[model samples]
Target: MSLLLSFGVLVLGFHHLQSIPDSWSQHYVFVKFGKEHTLECPLQGEGISWICPHNARSICSKASTRQKTLHLPNLSHKKSGLYTCTNALHQSYSTYLLIDEGQDLLNISCTSDSYTSSVLHCSMDKPFTGPSLLRVRSYSSNMTQEGKEMKIPQDENQNFLFDIQLPNSCPSEELMDPIQMSVEVMSSHEYTSRDLTFYRRDIVVPKTPENVTFTKEKIMWSNPSWTPYPSFFPLLFELTVRYRNNTIVTKRTEEQNYSAKDVQTIRVRCRDLYNPSSWSPWSPRLNVRA
Candidate 1:
């Protein structure tokens, strides 16, 4: 009788462990809008049940469950949320569903003035005309920066600008890892969030080459004043020169000095040689003759 009672207690403890859900085992799924998606339960057995996304009333009601699998057809933004599947033992697994509309309403871009600058400038283009709230956040391996929630006002050109101050400059060792940037826009009837991941070298927009001087025989320019340790980071300079006969000549070189003749107008741009990024904007159009 004593042995029988000990076996019963052991069974009860195992049942209790099975009834607890595993919160750490979560998954994320991204499905395009107006598409079909299927979710499967990790546990296999009878008496499997699913708790569909709460926001999708229609889907929750119509979703078909066959054993450990859930089939969802004709997905929409409303179908985005947590989906949980539970077995007879009450062991549950959850998946967060994300619905992508395919159409991106926010045109976002990030650029730094120089490799050594600590500020990152980001601009978003508003394609739709309406009042909305915008929130931005940036994340590095070590830290997360949250931007203040602001109302997006009507702009003449439909563009909004924001800046993020990094804890370290672009070329610093701390920023060598990947950084994540996210933007969320919310309006009365719509809500969307976009995330972008990039490395520091990917967004460096060096300052425009300065002090462009041109002569009949050669043209010379100096690197941007903000460039620190110019010897360590080589630059590739591009020269566009127009001749007297309305002809144009474009040349690329690693050196700051170039030899040319019959040049009417000249402008220069530079980019990093090792980790090339977007070329700096053409130095203010320099007219050699005028």
Candidate 2:
């Protein structure tokens, strides 16, 4: 009888250890900043209790508690932390609560110089006052590029700029496939992330047209030197003509030459023929004689 009791005690201790979850293993819970959320303990018993985040017991006091659930009415950055739930048997579970603003607070813009260029330039237009960290990553069909985390210093104008280079050059052919991109901004108490999808052709900004000359009721210009395979990837040129009477006329065409009867000044710009989302900066104004 003594041996059986000892064996039964050993079995009970082993079962108790198995019931307890690892303290280091924490499940992540994401919630919007100003929304209400309820956390349910995994262990259901009579003596179940919750341990609030360190130094944040006051915030938990405002929460409503049921038998095994804790309901938080207003979620904020201060409420984000590790929450542990314990039962009568001393078994416990932990969860990390992460709260976000749930909106695109960064207002990030990313673009490439050319369709075939491997480098992408990204900028944040939002003006921030404090120190923060910025990270950007890109995912293509065959490649993934992870960006390096860098500290963002406070600037006078509050604008921040960064560059991301892909592992391979963009494909020349028109591809419908889009590259997935994500930008993450981390601060002392707040974290925000934004995801963007774009095609290479959509973000290509052609170089400004050059060598503009006007003669004999006709205006001619040289295409951008950086443009590759002029026939395969055609460019659409936009011509802006200002007359002596202060009247302005804009015309778009695939040809680099234009003919007009009267003009005082003429400027030209170009964009991708297929994808016309981005236009290059206007070329230098060429004075013309009537």
Candidate 3:
């Protein structure tokens, strides 16, 4: 992610501060996150001095002035906002200054895929600009469900990457939406927040079943410990059984008992219980005289 979002333009409907000329093309400066960005206040002529923005007690920030330019450093979320520059005449060239964590100042990205595996990938954008701590946590899109999160990977360089395993899909309504994650970058006086989502579709799959066992009159089975599919809860499996006569039966549970005398041939397969199910191929035919 890019640390710098936008520069040289007023954003989010913020109007310019009063006191500048109508023709001055540059009145706004936006800084990137995690590092220092400079803001220059150009004056038409001298005799007019530069005054920093302030209230009753302190200015928004203490800055270094060369002539008309102001130097600000290590910008983050809290450092962002408006700063006006006034001259001795009380007339101002109040440049609307804004600072934000760079495009991905936290220098991070996260994702999960059904084909690869069910895991969260997180990493820094690059080497460290300054010392900081990063923490990653997971939650459901809605506030109700949370706590199934992965850990942040550790690395030697300031730029680090790691993978955290995700839990198998839970069999509940809470798993319907995408999984949300918050990556917090913590420094002494500043912090950055980055959010990413793992779409539910990418972590979902009809995992292969456990050993399919057949007894004289009873059929029983279970599912694998986990599947690569995206899900917040265990998946519902729709089980199908084919009889010797080629008749078929599908059920929501994993087990079935046959009581008929002709229950000699059986083949079984399963599918995910969600809409437009992902069905598996029929199991090998099992024939026995009992």
Candidate 4:
């Protein structure tokens, strides 16, 4: 009888440990500066707490009886980092945060009286420790849809500043609105990933002149606003001159001009890489006469 009782006790303890439910684990997409990003951490039995980086420190103390959604504050480019959640029972779960460093909205303020070209800088400042992707969209009556995209090299700091040209080919009768620019960043870890979004308003890029002017250098096909369609001439409107993943410095070279048989309108359009829902209203239509 004594041997039988001992055997039963051992069996109960082993069963209890084996039957413990696993913790919550899933993929999460976090927006840059979004409100109250919720991360649900659920576990079996009692004692649940959210931890950042490791189990030593807890983001929330005194585990609640029910599943908890860790409310994260507005995140920035630098906020991209590793996160973990664990239960008091010694069981833990891990995930990564990817913050896309780009603009969610664009707000442009132009001087009512200034004469020289206004300087507009667009960038994403979310912190992501990986490669970055950049996409630019240009809108005009004559150009293609779904602006151009470029794979920006990865970096830990996701701040970027790019210069764009304005519309010049549109006729005076039709005034073109300022171009919109969006930036996005994503973070990666061995076990997780996260993304963030940002936006800039009223970014102005120079427009190419209508008159016939030829350049010695040949244009590349990878530009977002460039199209080689046979129906329309291979006219280029926007140019990306320089770029840096960390500093977010993008500069444009000297103005470019392309002469076609007829004149047409030119407009710049960009969409947020992370959140396409938050985009600026289309710029005023710019009309150009040949």
Candidate 5:
């Protein structure tokens, strides 16, 4: 494959050639390394010559074509380029040859978790035995933002999953803003990339839960609840408490035992999922007695 700027371009007779006219048949094909390729010459006749893209002069000697067909076996880096065929009158036909060194088996699938938009899950069809890295980027309102490389464990299936959290206090304009996400899978030797464009209007941070009621195992602590509504996306709830005993922030879960702690103060907040870094502000504090 043409891996760098110097190796990737179409040049003809000194100046850089961008494209050919339709009359030229515009034959362009990609060949993998160590593969055979055949180039068909147009306007057949005698004194036929072939010119390689990198070199200025025509190829001479035994490296000639037969019956307007040039057969190349075991393709390599030295064989990669635009090949031009010409007649004695200087009339010529050309084809752009691209060398693909990347593994043809590589493919990626990326999807936002239906349970939670914050969590983007991606996987590769081909397993990479070598060093591998997965990178993601988001573009919104003409600005591009990038996330940290997610850990892709070398597993039997080569599958990977990760989540990205959006800020809860993000402005109203940004909630519905379009997000362009590009995911790249790289190996020690070769790499491939793909892009996804989406937006989150229904997945904005959840409003703070309300209706505070308290009970005391030791110090009275208020349990807050919100008027439940139908939710389209995954949601996570956060609780921030400040009391005479301690100040703490924690997510609500079935295993949580808040009454056991000498909780003196109480407030709460919640957000729709995307592993967002920010959360809703502390709600109005409840007067709980010790």
Candidate 6:
């Protein structure tokens, strides 16, 4: 009977031990770029050592065996990885770290007139992160030419506006497309890396109407004098809008008196003014019946 009782007690004790919770539990998660963060891991036993993944560095908390915390600073992209905390009581926990790619403030606009300067504006939404470095790149589609990198300092909260001289040699009228602009932001901290974000706005140009059709004509004469044929009038359309990489042109015929047998074909094409070698497929030929 005593042996039976002892066996029962042992079994109960073992079951109770198995149900015990881990000694360590993660209390907080921290992530930051170009800065430091503190992580908290609570443990129940003494001699608790927290080891981080980067290099097996040890962080000690003397507050209590049941509680531990560590401070991580000067974080960068390379520091982004799994972090682990462990203690002598066989307690362990893990977490992940992420550094934001950061953010930038930028504005870009273009104009067609050759005499005026093209405007490029840039800024940083959060100047507290550090001094911001701005870079501008421009490209001409027609000439297949890329401009030099232009740099500026962005240390304030307000927008940074800068005037850029358009390429002195504009693409010939046939090849001149709107200029393309891109911006990149760099962290002031030498240890941190930066990324590029692009903002594109095209130049607004006038367009010629295409597919001119006449449903019917109004007549003032009392007699019914109508012909199945319509007249064709001379219509002129100019390429008004410009694109940084491409061009679009549209043409339409003017409304005029036409004989019943008149049929006109309309064709429109878009090409890169700078690089004459490249051109867009011509729009489908439109047939006008008069």
TM-score for each prediction?
0.58, 0.63, 0.32, 0.28, 0.37, 0.28
Clashes of 3: 21
lDDT (Cα, tens digit) per residue for candidate 2, span 141-194: 767896756677655756788888765644654375677887765443345678
> Model 6: how large is the Cα RMSD against the reference?
22.1
In every candidate, how many clashes are there?
0, 0, 21, 41, 8, 18
lDDT of 6 at 180: 53
Candidate 5 overall lDDT versus native = 0.49
Candidate 3 per-residue lDDT over residues 1-290, each given as its tens digit: 12222223321111222222222123233344556655544444554444443321133333444245555556444444444545555555544333334335555655443323546655566323444445556665344332322222334566667665554444343345567766654332223457777565444444456566676557655555455333533445544556667677766653333333345555555544443344545555666465
When summed lDDT is taken over every stretch of 10 residues in candidate 6, the lowest stretch is 9-18
For residues 1-290, write the lDDT of model 6, one tens digit per residue: 22211111000000001011122112222234557765555445665555444432332333332345556567665444445556777877654444433333333433332212244333333322334334445554444233333233334545445544443342233123555555443332211123332212223121223333323431111101111111211122222222223343333222222222222443443321322222223434554444
Error of 4 at 12 (Å): 45
After superposition, the stretches of candidate 6 with alpha carbons farther than 4 Å from their true spots are 1-32, 42-51, 55-67, 86-93, 105-264, 267-290
Q: Tens-digit lDDT track for model 1 on 1-290?
A: 22221111100000001021122121233355667866767776677777865566555555365356666677665565556677888777665554443336668989887767767898988744665567677777767875646666655768888887665434655345777877765433234568888876788888889999986588999999878878656799999989888899899999988888777888899998877688998998878764
Highest lDDT scorer: 2
lDDT of each: 0.66, 0.67, 0.46, 0.33, 0.49, 0.34
| C-alpha root-mean-square deviation, candidate 3 | 14.8
Task: State, as a TM-score between 0 and 1, how close model 4 is to the true structure.
Answer: 0.28
Candidate 4 Cα errors over 4 Å, as ranges: 1-38, 41-52, 55-57, 60-68, 71-80, 84-130, 133-151, 154-174, 186-290
lDDT of 1 at 149: 66
Clashes (candidate 6): 18
Poorest stretch of ten by lDDT in candidate 1:
9-18
What local lDDT score does residue 288 receive in model 3, on the 0 to 100 scale? 49
What is the Cα-based lDDT of residue 21 in candidate 5? 26
